[model samples]
Target chain A: MFLNLIRWFRGFVVFEIMGRFPERFINLSTRQGHFVLFSRPRKDNFTAALLLCDYRTIRPIARKSGVRLKVRERHGLPFLLGKYKARCGLLIGLLLFLIITVFMQSFVWTIEFSGLTTISQSTLKEALAEEGVFVGAFKPTLDLSAVQRKIMKNIDEVGWMSVNIIGTKAEVEVKEKELKPHILEANVPCNIKAGMDGLILSMNTKYGKAVVSSGSAVIKGSLLVSAVVENPSGDVSIVHADAKVMAQTQRTKSFVLERKGVFDKPTDEASRYRLRAFWLEFPITATSVKQSYTSRFETKSVFLNNTEMPISVTVEHCSRFSPNIYSLSQSEAQGIFAVEDYLYRLFSLSECESINAQRHYAETDSFYSMDVLYECEEDIAVYENLVVN
Target chain B: MNRKKIKSEQDKQNNSFGFNIKDAFSLKPRIEIFDNTSAVIDGSCGVLEYSETVIRVSLGELSLKLCGRGLTLKCISPTSLIVGGFIKSVEYIM
Candidate 1:
């Protein structure tokens, strides 16, 4: 394939050598140390293809050997390009296409990430973009090892990483750092106390002496189990306390909701397109919205033969809309309150054996106020480190 | 001028490198054929005849004839020639 390309680049001609003895012409042409591509004997004449320069040099040799050389065909790059001299635009367009293809290869189009969990893809992309390895980034100017080091430095969660560039695509592989668990020291003396103010419902004492019984009201920091263990033989010892103290608790919260607000509704969307060639991105057209508008950016990458191209299309869609005033209806306010009340039940009162809730709402001319109360039974066991005095 | 004196004189002029010492100090022409497909002739003076199936080269004392199908002269330098085709046979004419 490359040989034909090279042959075309250097123009060649096919000549028909006809005379008394074509062999003499062929021999005399080569006897001067000139190379002929090929010479085949026909019925009466021999046809040989030679470089155009060689053909010009061998004209006298043909005459001296009594053979007349008639050029049968002219081919190669110069002749092919000369045929289209009249069409200047096509030639210019071809040149431009070649330049664009070369330029597009110098940018990174698609970035692929693998071996990431717990850590987000956007976080790593941000870190990589800071280190010059993002989409539309110039590929040639990137220092891959430096990019890896910077990314590792920027994100503490990423323990190790590598950046590999294959054509227009950048492949990023990462291993996330594992967090070590905090474990309390064993055989340490401790005490169990009430983490919140609640009435004691039950007790499960595993170690130490129980200080509070069922149905006893206790406040925060009130010890339910003591680490001082007294033996029947009149000997006392300190031990690590372990206990589960179930309690009934009550919680109250309030929220204020505004009565008036404005929200936007998208009316008409206009898009601005940009052509991205590697590191260069230029707008094809600009769109201006007089009203308030929100923009959404999207990049469409081009691929050839499963390999990504650095060329891409960036579209910024502008949704032109203005905010309209609307007051929150009573039912909408109630809906918001119901949602908040449900969250409270799900998060605050979670794992409770039994729960009772009361909701109150007070409305003024300007805003609405919601008060939520939750009554529930849960474990309020808290471990307190013993102070050695 | 007896036969023995003539033999002794010819022996004195014999060349160790030239194969054709009898041809009066003429070096031997070398013809190499490759798998009946191509032929290379060294020490050839010029081409005498050319055709699609036959090519005759002059080697000072004899003409090196090549018989083949679709024969073509791949190279024809002053002292060497290369023939490319399906070569049927090669002959050296005295």
Candidate 2:
């Protein structure tokens, strides 16, 4: 039965291949609602040998030709050859279907984008074409994240960007960092007093009444301009005047400290070193590397608009700690260990810093914890716009 | 009689060695030949073989009786039809 089915299928294939020929096959002819053909191509003329006819009248012709013929009528073949021929209409339909399927699957139908920047849509689309991911690209092979990273790297103005493929389309969403201009409001009707006491350098007043001139000296918290004005009518009128009053005054800020320490032969004999391995242990470990510092580590972290958006990762970091006595000392034997340890830390921190060392010292074992104090200052020039009401 | 003689002569002239025996007669023939040669005169082309009582034509599916006959068709070869018949005249139409 299986063989018979295979034969039937093979016959179908044969019918399909032969059905493609034109209307002039030799032993082939169309009939009323049916067609039959003998397809015996001569070896040399393999393209030309097919004959068809109606069963109504070929009998006597064969008899006169003296050709012995056989008629194959299946007792249970179920489908007749004539019927099969009539159903050959499916061939054209199937061909059309295959052509349409191939056409539909050939082109890219959609595009999606993610992680885009201030880059415009058209610019991003053009950039995507450079990476072979344009409107018509085959979506499956496109590495969206890689394309996003490429775009972000190429356009550094982009603070954050992403490319995502949803279905057959690429969705590019960009997060652009825009620096907003700061608007400083000097709404208080106050005079620009001396920030620090110093000798009068030169006074420049763009607006408002300047009470002190270039040679005049002013003290801290002393008002240089007044918002009160006396007119010719002897009427006192208070106007909200805005001004820039610059005065140079003599200033002095000093810090004096007297140090005292009573250290008579600090005692240290033995030190114990503990080695703890986490070895995949999580949550908490055998030992935690917590620095015992007396001072807090000062870091300036900026949040997105100062509102706790996880964007507030650390920016500037200045740790507060004093070094370990042993680590501070350049002692011959301890120096090796310190050097090795520092080398390991330096290797681990290669992504974030360039280390610089200034000094080496040896201290007594007073059991003092690590402490760091920073006194860094910058000569900052600030604009003080005074407005008077 | 004249019609029969004229049909015989026409069969003699048109029927080639490989003509489908079923193409020329309505009386189903006992034998059939698949002619690679098409009908030189352009009617439904095939072959036929028949006796006085039956007709066989390579219409691919018909067993129509003409001039009184019952005919049965069987496969003798891939390109042949063996048609058996009962009674009456046979003729080649194409």
Q: Pick the candidate with the highest TM-score.
A: 1
Error of 1 at B44 (Å): 3.5
lDDT, model 1: 0.85
Q: Runs in model 2 with CA error above 4 Å?
A: A1-189, A199-202, A247-389, B1-42, B47-94
Model 2 fnat value: 0.03
The model with the greatest DockQ is 1
**DockQ values of all predictions:** 0.51, 0.04
Q: Over the stretch A253-336, how does candidate 1's per-residue lDDT look in tens digits?
A: 897788997887777889999999766789999776654678889999898887666678999888877778879988899999
Q: Judged by lDDT, which candidate is best? A: 1
User: What's the residue-level lDDT of B92 in candidate 2?
Assistant: 43
The superposed Cα distance between candidate 1 and the true structure at residue A229, in angstroms, equals 2.9
lDDT, model 1, position A113:
90
Residue A140 CA error for candidate 2 (Å)?
A: 20
